[model samples]
Target: MSSDDTHVGLHPDDLDLLERLGRIAAVVDPVPDEVLELGRAAFELHRADALLMSLVADAGAAVRDNGAATASHLVVFELGETSVEVEVARRGEFVRVIGVVMAADQPYAGECRVSLETSASTTTQTLDDGRFAFERVPVGLARLVLDREGDQPMRTPWFDAR
Candidate 1:
C-alpha cells in the first residue's frame, strides 16, 4: 500500500495494538514519534502486519502526550554545582522570575544579577539564602540571564508566556 493509504486511518485491531505498544514503549523510550510514524505507514500499507502495526501505533500516542506535558508557562532551571533554583512565570504582559539560592558550603554571601533581554533591565543584589525575585517584566520572547561575580551567568531556557 502507499503512504497515502496509511495516513487515512488504522484498523480497530491495529489501533488497539498500537495503544498497547505505545504504553509499553513509553516506559523506556518515553516518546516514540518514529515508532508512531512507522505504525502510521504500516497502517497505510493496509496489510495484515498486526505485530509491526501495533508497535508503531503505541509509540506514536506516547510521543504526543509527552510533547503536550512539557508545554508549560513556567520554566525551571538547575545549574551544576550551584545551590539555586530559578522559576520563571509569564503573567499577561509581565514575566516574573523567582530565584532561590542556597549556601551549601561557605558563608553564602554573593551578588546575583538578573537581566531581561526584552526589557533590557538588570537587577543586582547580595543573595540572602541566595534568593531573589523579579516582577513586572514585559512578556514575549524574553531571556533571563543570571550572573554572579565568580561564577558564569546562566540563561533560563526559552519559553512562551502566552
Candidate 2:
C-alpha cells in the first residue's frame, strides 16, 4: 500500500484509539509501504510468530506516541563504526527520547545514550529505543546531553523551560 492510501483521514476509530492512549494532539501520519514491506519480510525470513508480531505492534504504538513525525529535533551521532539517530520531544512534564542505532550497513542493534541535565542533577547511560524518559524535570533552564562515547558529545546549550 502507498503512504497516501494508508492515510485514513481522521476516522472515528483512529480518534478513539488516540484519545484512549492520551494522545489528543498527536498527528497520525501514514506508515510508509517500504516499512511495512520490511516488517513483513523480517517476519517471514525469521519465522517470527504471533508473539513477535504483537511486540512489533506495541513498539509501533510507542513510536507513534513519542511524536516520531513531529519530533522537535533529531540528534545524529557517529560513534566507532556505528550511526545512531535519536528523536527528542517535550511531552507533558518531561522530555521523551527515542532512538535507533545501526552499525554501518547492519540492521538496527538498538544502542544509544540520552541524558537530561539540570543545575542540580545529571544522568547518563545507554538505552533501548522505547526505554529512555526523564520525569519530574523541574521547570527551569536545562540541557539535553547526547553522548555516544567515542564521538564528540553534543549538548543543547541550556534552554530555559522544561
Candidate 3:
C-alpha cells in the first residue's frame, strides 16, 4: 500500500457489482432526508410532550362518584397556572375517564386527546367548557395531552388507565 494508492482485497468485477447493487437499492427504496428528519422529530416530541403530571389521587382509593356504588379513581395534576382533573371509572371491561383542564385564570379552550401507550391514532376532541372524556378505552397505560389556543401544550402523567 502506498500513500497515493487505494485498493481493497476484492476482484474488480466484485467491486463493480457491489457499487451497482448499492445504486439500485438507493433508487428503488430511498429514504429521503426530510423523512429522516421527521422521524427524529417525532421521537423527540413524544418525550417532550409527555409532561408527566402529579397524581393527587391514585387508583383504588376511596372516592365517591356522583353517589354511585361503583369504584372510581380521582387523579389531579397541577401545572404552572394550569391544572387537570381526571376521574377514572369502569363502564365495562374498558375504562371511561372524564377530565377537566382548568387554569388559575385562563383555562384551555382547545383540543384534548387521550392516547394509550400501545396506540398511534388517539381519541381527540375540542375541549368544551374545559371538559373532555375518553370512552371504552382499554385498560392500560394512558396519558392526556392538551393543545390550548395561544398557550403551550401540556400532558398528564400516565394514569392507571383502567
Candidate 4:
C-alpha cells in the first residue's frame, strides 16, 4: 500500500473534484481585478541590481464644484537614501504626471531618466533639474522607473493613475 514503491496516477474523478473545488472557490472568494493587476506588475522583470522603491505617500485628487478633477495628487516613494515625489493631475480625458527625485543627504545631480509605465504604454523623460513630466498619459495602472548612469536603477510600485 506504500505509494513510494509504485507509480502513482491521478484518476479522472480526482480532476473533476479539483475543478469543482476551484469553481466553488471562485464563487465564494474571487480575486479582485486590481489585486491581480498589481500582482502582475509587481512580478514584471526589472534590472537584477535595481532597487525597489516603497510608496510613502498618496494624496488623492480633489473634485471641483462642477465635478471637474483638479491636479495636486501627490505621491511619494522612497528607497534607501533616495526619494521620488510625484504629482498626478487629470488633464481632460488623460492624466499628467510630474516628478522630482531627491537624495536625503545631498542634492540629486546625476543624469537620470524617468519612465512612466503602464500595461498599455511607456513614456520616458530625461530629468531636468531632477524633475520630469509626462502629459496626456493614459489612465490606468501605472508605475515609475528611474535609471541613472553608473547607479542602481529604482522603481516604484504599481499605482492607479485614475
In Å, residue 129's CA in model 4 sits off its true spot by: 0.6
lDDT of each: 0.48, 0.48, 0.66, 0.79
lDDT of 4 by residue, 116-160 (tens): 988767778888888888887777778888999887788898887
Deviation (Å) of 27 in candidate 1: 46
Top-scoring candidate (lDDT): 4
Badly placed stretches (over 4 Å) of model 4 are 1-43, 46-49, 65-67, 105-107
What lDDT score goes with residue 157 in model 2?
A: 41
lDDT of 3 by residue, 54-90 (tens): 6665656544567755557788887776788888886
Q: Tens digits of per-residue lDDT for model 2 on 1-162?
A: 111233468677776676655543434555688987886555343212111100111111223554543224455555455454545555454455555555675634454575666665676666564245555454455545555546455444444432
Candidate 1 — which residues are off by over 4 angstroms?
1-73, 102-109, 119-126
TM-score (C-alpha) between model 3 and the true structure: 0.57
Per-model TM values vs. the true structure: 0.40, 0.34, 0.57, 0.68
Candidate 1 local lDDT, 40-95, one digit each (tens): 55533432321110101101111224344221233444445444444555444455
- The better-scoring model by lDDT among 2 and 3 is 3
Model 1, TM vs. native: 0.40
Number of the predicted model whose TM-score against the real structure is largest: 4
**CA lDDT of 123 in candidate 2?**
65
Ranking by TM-score: 4, 3, 1, 2
